[model samples]
Target: MKRRTRLVSIVLAAVMLLLSACNINMGESKEPAKGTDSGPKTEVGAQKVVFWHAMGGATTKVVDQLVANFNASQDKVQVEAVYQGTYDDLLSKLKASMGTNEGPSVVQMYEIGSRFMIDSKLITPMQEFIDADQWDVSQLEPNISGYYTFENQLYSMPFNSSNPILYYNKDLFKDAGLDPESPPRTFEELKIAADTISKKGKAVGANFAIYGWFMEQLFANQGAEYVNNGNGRDDLATESLVNTEAGVKVLTWWKDLIDSKAANNLGRKTDDSKKAFSAGQVAMILDSTAALKGLVDSADGKFEVGTGFLPKPEGAGEGGVIVGGASLWMMNSRPEAEQKAAWEFIKFLTSPSEQAYWHINTGYFPITTKAYEEESVKENLKKFPQFQTAIDQLHQTKLVKATQGAVMGVFPEARQIVEGAIEEVLNNKKSPQQALDDAAKEITAKIQDYNRTVK
Candidate 1:
């Protein structure tokens, strides 16, 4: 009986040992299985960057093609271009997005928004990157570079820079008994031609769809400084020469044009003005060269169009017209790698070939000198001589200065005030001097408020 009991205990001990070994094996198997289930990790590649732009239509297509080409050219980066609406919409969206940390890596900013962006600290100075890369900025046009520089440091790169040019309908000019080939070279000649066309032509003699652009060019052509110290970055307390003799003269001329029915005052919207011109309601227009493509498209081969340099004030001498176009600004919310990639994409977009393509396709002036020298651009220019009008005007400009391009904070609001003043004068509600003086005072007050906040 004792031997049988001992055998039973030995068998139970062996069974317990086997159970313990099985448990040990099961525990060891779990770790390898867990690790294998985790799967192979993906190595993160080039950072993806998002850019917000206010370009659409053919311009957007060009941008898409460029982005695709850039991505295909390199495996280290991918750039995505997003259309964020008009210039005003972009600004509003950007201001709203400031509260959140979800802004884009890059943004296309308007010329007037430069000061506001700088004051808000929303943009990263591009000069830092240029310095770090040891880039040859000398290759860029000095006037274009000057447009983007703030306190000697460039905050953005001028991408689609353009100046206003005079576009006339050749058929209308001939009908008005004016030389079709001889465009107005002076404001006096423009007034005469406009008066003649108003009597004979089917539409208004002359029109300027964009008031701020017209005022900028008018001030520059008259050799009048919009702000003191030559740099537009100064304070409102400094002085506002916008109501000076030259200003009053230009304002009066605009009033005379409207009063005489030589020119019609279309609403402030670009589309309104474009519609009027396209429908042959306006014989001539002073508008951005960027609109050349749209004008041609709208013409439908119905009229012979001629583009020429903007007419200057009589005896004002040759002066530069301020550039009016969008610029690419680097946002502060991006990572360093993404910022570098954004810069690379900017370089690609501004490359000679790319600039040429854009200029030919969109009618925007090439931002780089190399583009002007490209064989493709030359051939294209030969085919469309009007394409060179913007370039010629830009080259002929003298003494590039900030006074030519007003960069005051709250300039967008100031422009609205000025436009209101212009409307008042056009509607005969106020005299030219009164309207402009009121506008000047209002703009100065806004500038003061902006300066106080920024300071």
Candidate 2:
């Protein structure tokens, strides 16, 4: 009893010290209150902030370069970026490390993971950090940041962002006697072009990666809901709305293309369909704007890549694209100094110059509006006119919950379930309506389980 009492006292003392050091009084509630502004930054000696991210391959090179620039720009702080596999892998590792002292000071979590991050209460809201410096975020494109804002407060900083776009082969278009400049803007027109291309044997009419993300975007394009409770923004989501009549239309269109052999039945991995396009086996594809740089590099001599706005469901919804990407979050469990250092790194990364460099190197769209004005960004756009399609799409987006995107704790799992349904339809194992209904049933059960834990 004496030893146990002593250990309890020690633990309480440590908790008090942590709370006081970060400017919180733990006597009030368990909720994480804001830290003090602490005035201007004072130089701290070689403080290292660990950032765990998910970027890999060529994009990882750009991430490392930005880190090098940030380190060279400052003497007081140093950032060490550690690659933690894909976004799904990163989220799993982050969850496993929560509340442990060994966790990273910062992490890059995708938009779908934001809901879990908030409920976990393991990170400082980026808005509080911004408020400390009284920084203005007016330059941030709302279409991108809107997805991260919850209850009127921004929780994470938007980093690499993009929306889906239609990528087509100009050479195929010319061969089919179709105008390369006038690609399809609606589902009806896409079929017309795909039919002509398939009949001509130039390549498979169109190819899709069987990605649930694209399916979600298709619903958003038609102003449809993927989940209930205003996409889990107004409150926690309890059921999925993705099995609706209009929602099934998306799956039907995709399934029909595969059945008609107009679109290749590429697997769930985005890379599969991308490789098909680069090899000149597919005439057109639908994928993220983040693929712009790689697509150009891979298809440099093979064919001219032409990009256009994502095709809308024939005459429906307010025609907009959902901005998708990961965001940088500062975990609040560490000392206040480390948290501040992480924020410093994030601020530097989002600056116009760094963002312009990032945009030129990787295909991911920059969140900062001023980045487009940079000479480097201008030069890149002049070299690759295909990028302007994404820029225009971003400008035309309206901030509704449908366009802002759905956020739920189980969204990652939800995506997997939807992908399975897509496979079934493509393989002719189920009808569009039957596939969606079955997926909705499974997703609804999972949502109920997830909500129970939160409550």
Candidate 3:
């Protein structure tokens, strides 16, 4: 009995030792315990920072890879990327979060919302951070970051910047007896080609995905001021100037296309318009360059896609298409350390390699000059020269005034009013001048109400 008891005691001691060794290894392999600084202690570190964005698919993958690269490149920062839905959804969430002080450290915002973000004070001025870091602003494209600047202060960093382009189905174009290599350069040419294609029953004429963007580009191309002083900023009177001779002319042209059955209302939804184009239901589409990946994917090697510069007004001079894409806005609600981390992440994202990746993957123009100089970008550009169309357009931009691209306040509602006006004109419910005049009045009222609140 004594021998057996000694043996049992030896076995229990061995088992306990084994368990102790295993526990030590497990602890080392696992993350540091809460409140415990298991890794190297570093100054100016954040525990974790959250970023809210609306990017998805290939773009989302690119963002994820960038986040992973950033996390791996640093020891003191960990970033959590959260998808917050569409642009509107992101704004709604931001507003709600601000009310409760629960917003993310960074948010991806659309260009139209830049004014609102600046006015709300929801974002911090990025210029201060850039100056403090002594970052190389020269590495970026000139005035590329300026799109998000309001009142001479940079509120956000340009991320996925893009402009509308004319995408055509090569197969459809050929079927309609149009040369795929030679795209329409003027509105009249586009109309003629669209009419021919529609007559051939190969597809509907030309359809625009975003009516607002199309209108903006049309106005710019024709040197028509959408707002007084050509800036889309300031008071109601300034914005109401969109109800002008040039504006009426553009709207009238749109109405004529629909009235002649050369074009059809593909609906305001971008996806629907894309589907129509991909399925050969529509031969031509004016949409963001960002949609290239989707169109390519959905094409599934069935159709050849061609991209070209947006069609110009018949007598319009060289003009720039307004930039339309999202930017990265750093939130003020986060801890200073987290804010710094967020800035670092932003830098990583805007790095040349990341920008190249984003541009190649999403069809968005790279905001960094280094990205344009990179070999990968050069190779892609060599193969697809049309990809540089947006950059070329930017070079000729005059940037008339804030009201041209800096309208804040009730823009979302105002856009709806404008769209309604577009619908009325297209459907012949009202003439272009009458429709735009009515829209201007409605939009003016909304702007007044918004100004009252802000004042």
Residue-by-residue lDDT tens digits, candidate 2, 192-299: 899889999869999988888998998888888789999899999999887997668888888778778888887988888899999999999999998987898899
With candidate 3 superimposed using the best TM-score fit, by how many Å does residue 27's alpha carbon deviate from the native?
Answer: 12
lDDT of 3 by residue, 1-455 (tens): 99999999999999989998886443232333445433211223435677899996657888887788888897777888898888899889889899554678889988877767876876778887898999877776654666666556666899888777788888878888889998887878888888989999768988875467677667766666555533544343334556877678777767777777787886678888988998889888888877776776677678887887777767775466677788898887565666887888898888888899889877888888888878988997776666666667666666655313636466677677778888877766888898889988877676667667767
lDDT of 1 by residue, 322-382 (tens): 8788899998655566688789988888789989888888787888888888999999888
- Model 1 residue 220 CA deviation (Å) reads 1.4
Model 3 has a clash total of 5
After aligning candidate 3 to the native by TM-score, how far in Å is the CA of 31 from where it should be? 19
Worst 10 residues of 2 by lDDT: 36-45
Residue 391, model 3, lDDT: 68
Off by over 4 Å in 3: 1-46, 229-238, 382-385, 402-404
Give the candidates in order of lDDT, highest first: 2, 1, 3
Model 3 scores a TM of 0.84
Q: Residue 155 error for model 3, in Å? A: 1.8
* TM-scores for every predicted model: 0.86, 0.89, 0.84
TM-score of 1: 0.86
Question: Which 10-residue span in candidate 1 carries the lowest summed lDDT?
Answer: 34-43
* Ranking of predictions according to TM-score: 2, 1, 3
Q: Give the TM-score of candidate 2.
A: 0.89
Best by lDDT: 2
The model with the greater lDDT, 2 or 3, is 2
